[model samples]
Target chain A: QQQVKQSPQSLIVQKGGISIINCAYENTAFDYFPWYQQFPGKGPALLIAIRPDVSEKKEGRFTISFNKSAKQFSLHIMDSQPGDSATYFCAATENSGYSTLTFGKGTMLLVSP
Target chain B: DAGVTQSPTHLIKTRGQQVTLRCSPKSGHDTVSWYQQALGQGPQFIFQYYEEEERQRGNFPDRFSGHQFPNYSSELNVNALLLGDSALYLCASSLTPGKPQHFGDGTRLSIL
Candidate 1:
């Protein structure tokens, strides 16, 4: 079962534009939501994460706006640049060891110069 | 310190063959989990090992198994490989149960 669902399988934006990716989950037990960015040949790197307790978390150009009641969260990248063009994955995990993370299919974001 | 490290960045094997992939967790991390990512798909969990034992597993076949060593390093072994087994195998590490995980570059395995 796909515990989390993401929208816009792919995206393209102009430089300096706002890039948004949305995700929704059916499992309310999920407490930790994290976003990852992956290059073509590398692994996914942690971007920003938000716990259900918080409605929003921001770091630099990345922000996670979470809505606990709606079971949804979205990643926003401000001033999107060419470097920001990569695949983004939103994942949910409740606890640590022995547990698995539920991830969305991923969004391939391309920022044009 | 080095983050999670995986060996043999890329490999190719024939059907019916067996292969072993290895992973060394990041410094201060104690748990290891394995994931498989097919083309254009998100990663799927296989199993997780902590304290030298597999504590949880996903819906995979018996052919996929793993082990954790005393040093928190782990190995994933796939037996009787099939063409469908071709994918990128990833290893994620965390300090303990329920923490956010850090991932390795992954090993791309192609079955012929």
Candidate 2:
């Protein structure tokens, strides 16, 4: 079973526009949600994360909006830039146990200038 | 301090052969996790090691095993490799299990 599901296998956005990626999870046990960005020939890097306790968390131009009751979350990038083009993965894990992250299939985002 | 470091950026192995990939965690980190990422797919967790012991494991087979040394370095060994095993192997390190992990560039393994 895929614990987490992400939408839009691929997305194209104009530079300076808002880019959004959506994710829904099946396991209500999951309390931590994190997004990772991966570049070619590199490993995935932590982008932004949000805990279920907060409805929204923002850092700089990146924001994570979470809905616990809906078991859904979304990542919103403001002022998307060409440099932001990369594959994004949304993951979730139950905080009570070991940190085994269940990830989504991944979404490839392209921000064109 | 150096981030998570993995060796042998790439490797080629024939079916039925065996291979080992190594990883050194970032400074002061204590936990190491291994993941396998197939083409066009997100990473799949293999297992995690903490305090030189396997703490958590995913749904992979016994052919995939790992070890963690006192220095907080780890090794992943795959036995009787199959063509389907070809993928990018990634290593991530964190101060604690389940925290935000720092990843290495990864080792690309191709099975012939």
Candidate 3:
């Protein structure tokens, strides 16, 4: 069972355009939602994170819009640049001390300059 | 200051062999977790260690085992390697078990 499901396995956007990726989760126990960016041959880096208490959280050009009732969340990147071309992963985990993350397959985004 | 450091960066093993991978956590972190990432897929959790004990584990087989030292560094061991075990093994560290984890570049393990 895939607890977290992400849409649009891949994406392409022009530089300076807005890029959006969506995710839906089946586990209601999940309280913390985070996004990670990974470049080829490297490890996944923490990008942005949000809690169920907030409907939205924005950090720089990256924004995470979360809907607790709907069990859904989305990531929006403003002014997408060529540097943003990489794989984005959405993950969820419970607030319990021993909880492990459940990750979405991933979305590969490409920004053309 | 060092986020997370994994050893060897790459390794190759044949079937029925055994391997060990190492990880050093961030300076102040105390928890270590292991993950396996197949090509073109997201990483899957293996297990986590805290206070030199296995606190939590994922659904991986018994073949995957780990150890956490007194310094918070960890090691992953796999016995009787199988071709299906070929993947990028990632190590992550956090201040606590459920806290935000920092990842290393990972060690690419290939099984023949």
Q: What is the per-residue lDDT of model 2 for residues A1-113, given as tens digits with 9 covering 90 to 100?
A: 99999988999999999999999999989988989999999999999989898999999999999998999999999999999999999988887435698899999999999
TM-score of chain B of each: 0.99, 0.98, 0.98
lDDT tens per residue, model 3, B1-112: 6789999899999999999999999999999999999988889999999999998899999999999999899999999999999999999999887789999999999998
- Where is the poorest 10-residue window by lDDT in model 3 chain B? B94-103
Model 1 reaches what TM-score against the true structure? Answer: 0.97
The candidates' DockQ values read: 0.66, 0.73, 0.72
Every candidate's TM-score, chain A alone: 0.96, 0.97, 0.97
The lDDT for every candidate, in the order shown, is 0.92, 0.94, 0.94
> Judged by lDDT, which candidate is best?
2
* lDDT (10s digit) by residue, model 1, range A4-100: 9997899999999999999999987888899989999898888988888889999999999999999999999999999999999999987531257
CA lDDT, candidate 2, residue A39: 98
Question: What DockQ number belongs to candidate 3?
Answer: 0.72
Per-residue lDDT of A1-113 in model 3, one digit per residue for the tens? 88999988999999999999999999888988989999999999999999998999999999999988899999999999999999999999987535998889999999999
**What lDDT score is found at residue B16 in candidate 3?**
96
Candidates 1 and 2: which is better by TM-score?
2
Interface RMSD of 2: 1.8
The docking quality of candidate 2, as DockQ, is 0.73
Model 1: per-residue Cα lDDT over B2-92, one tens digit each: 9999998999999999999999999999999999989887889999998999988998999999999999999999999999999999999
> How close to the true structure is residue B37 of candidate 1, measured as C-alpha lDDT?
88
